[model samples]
Target: MSEENKQIAQELIDAVGGLENISSVAHCATRLRIMVKDKEKIDQNRAEDIDKVKGAYYNAGQYQVIFGTGTVNRIYEQFIALGAPESTKSEQKEETKKQGNKFQQIIRTFGDIFVPIIPVLVATGLFMGLRGLVTQEEILALFGTSPDALSDNFMLYTQVLTDTAFAFLPALVAWSAFRVFGGSPVIGIVLGLMLVNPELPNAYAVGEGEADPLMFLGFIPVVGYQGSVLPAFIAGFLGAKLEKWLRQRVAESLDLILTPFLTLLIMITGALLVIGPIFSAVEAAIMAGTTFVLQLPFGLSGLLVGGLHQVIVITGVHHIFNLFEIQLLADDGMNPFNALITAGIAAQGGAALAVALKTRSKKLKALAFPSSISAFLGITEPAIFGVNLRYIKPFAMALIGGAAGGFFAALFNLEASGMAITVIPGSLLYVYDFVPLMLYVITNVIALGTAFVLTWMFGFSDKMLEEVKTE
Candidate 1:
């Protein structure tokens, strides 16, 4: 790590209640996720004031310090080198499970298990969008070929790039879930593979009536878990707990061989006989509910999702939406949720920019401007925690802006071909259609302009700027 990272690491440790107070430390895509023994001892304001620290927030029993993407990993290494105990995703999940009520714990567990796997999904989403772009009628015509005339090899390559992740989504979900539940990730993967084995008919095929589900134990019907979320996650959790229980009871000499064998034997049976069918039904119901909600009349769905999406982000439960968006893409080939989320994110940036423009203090402007840019680029912690949310009125104005934007998005029926990535980069996801692309641009503009105008009029005051300057 660089000297700057080392210094930032030390300041972060001190800011989060020092090394003694920190029980475990980890990093996600853009935050230093720390589990501390004494949350009250830490000064959140002081922590946010650190030069490299963009913002800080406590969610699901973890204090996450936003340091952006690349910088966070460096600071994480430095923090570990400085004697902060390194924590895995599983340890973090365990800590979270100890802190909350049953409902909160379930939500937190979902976030912990899914967050580490988002990058892979994001990459696959981008590829899906890119594949759509390259295979577009115009793009193909430019290459002297139509969709029907495209070569089988080219189509095969595109399928490999775009379909593999969703096709084996259960495996990815299971791997992450098992890791979060403190089990061997490879075993988790193998269990996931078993759920989607080629020997069994594909899940989608069974749903489409192209194949039949095999009968298990003469009663329960078993099918492949490909592209399924809840089933894989539940299986991984149960498998990990079972594996741990076996490890404790089994003899040490034969532990390695017998433990895995027994774990797999029991888990496979449980998954097929019980977990798979039940949770798959639950997942289907949830997806159906989500679809129904998103399809509500007069753009009410977008208004609700857009206005409150960032609030979910504040609690760090926003990661659950990744499953929703991915499922939407797999089933419908378009993600309208991403369109709504983009509006919310763009509103944050707009409010931040409004704050930057209204403030006379250079220090305040310095924080607001870059934070606004980061929000526009699909990251909003800096804008939300560092600027808008700090000023309650600005945050409220942003919510209204988001609601407006989302309303228009639903009215326009805006959609994206991808799950993650929004605002400027998200444009790539809609390149196959001109109208959706145009609506996406207009939706963001509505979010930005509405928030900017609203915040400028009602969200700020000279007194507030002066107080911010003094701080």
Candidate 2:
């Protein structure tokens, strides 16, 4: 490692309050995820204030500090240099289980697990969308008049890659969460796999009308904990605690065989019997609350599509909406969330594009442009972080544009036939749906274009661009 890199990493560790303060640490493709014992100890606002720090968030039980691509590696090297091991720590012997503030803990745990996995999820989602284009019969039929004979290879390939992520994602999250809580990753992975595996469908009663499949052990009362953002987190938290408790009682010599076996037995059982019900109730309540909000008198659909979508984007829990969309499609023949996401993407992209054109700083313009373009294509993370997020004006512009778009969609009583991107080419499959294909295309284009125009007219400042670029 370069001495300079080591020095920077050490400084980061020190700034965050030494290696001991860390419960667990990991990195995504771009950010460093640090789970600390106490959020109060770290100056989150100060970290964000640093010119070098791109963004910082405290969510789902984890404290996240974002750095551009290469920063995580540098931080990791420094962590090693400071004699702090990269692997998770052994489970701490004693934890007070009196259950503190339940809501806050759940949020923190959710953040720790989900924020790091977002890049992979987005990549896979985009890939799945592309694969649909390659395999759709009508698309291929357009090329060669034989609709029925269109090849399934593209669809198959996409399905396999996409399913691999979805099928095993619980395991992936569990591994990350366990590490966050400072426990054995292997055991956590096993627990996650158990939750998502289809063959052993765990059953959960989600009220009177719905019987949601738990998809793990039948013992859990919560439904569809598989691929669930919260349950995996709760499982990891409980799993880590259970593992630690077992580790203390077993003799050192028999630890190797007994520790894992006993931990698995206890954690899995505990998860199914206790943790699942509690988490399921919480999930049910949140969904119920959101649904209730959508029933409000003040154009509930527009408010939800515009306001809640923004909140989810910031917390990075927006991915949860994908599952909800799929569920709605399967159950209700329509999905409001899908429409909202499409509109949100258009709004965000438009705002970024507007800012890009108005900014005189060549570097800021360069960064903002590509990020905005990608946002139009339905991947908004880059734009959200690199462009619109910090620019107060752009985000507001996007939200207003999004609200306008979503309100139009709801007014027309539009419904997507399937999950598809809002872009012109991607909306081809929804051509025959309740909302005409032409309207869908025009709505997104207008929303995005209007946002860009408004951003330029009201929010543009070359000085602001220069300040951001120089910093």
lDDT of each model, Cα atoms only? 0.86, 0.63
Instruction: Report the lDDT tens digits of candidate 1 across residue range 225-277.
Output: 77888888899999999999999999999998999999999999999889988
TM-score of 1: 0.87
Full-model lDDT, candidate 1: 0.86
Q: Choose the strongest candidate by TM-score.
A: 1
Best by lDDT: 1
Cα error, residue 440 of model 2, in Å, equals 5.9
Q: Single out the weakest 10-residue window by summed lDDT for candidate 1.
A: 462-471
Count of clashes, each model? 0, 11
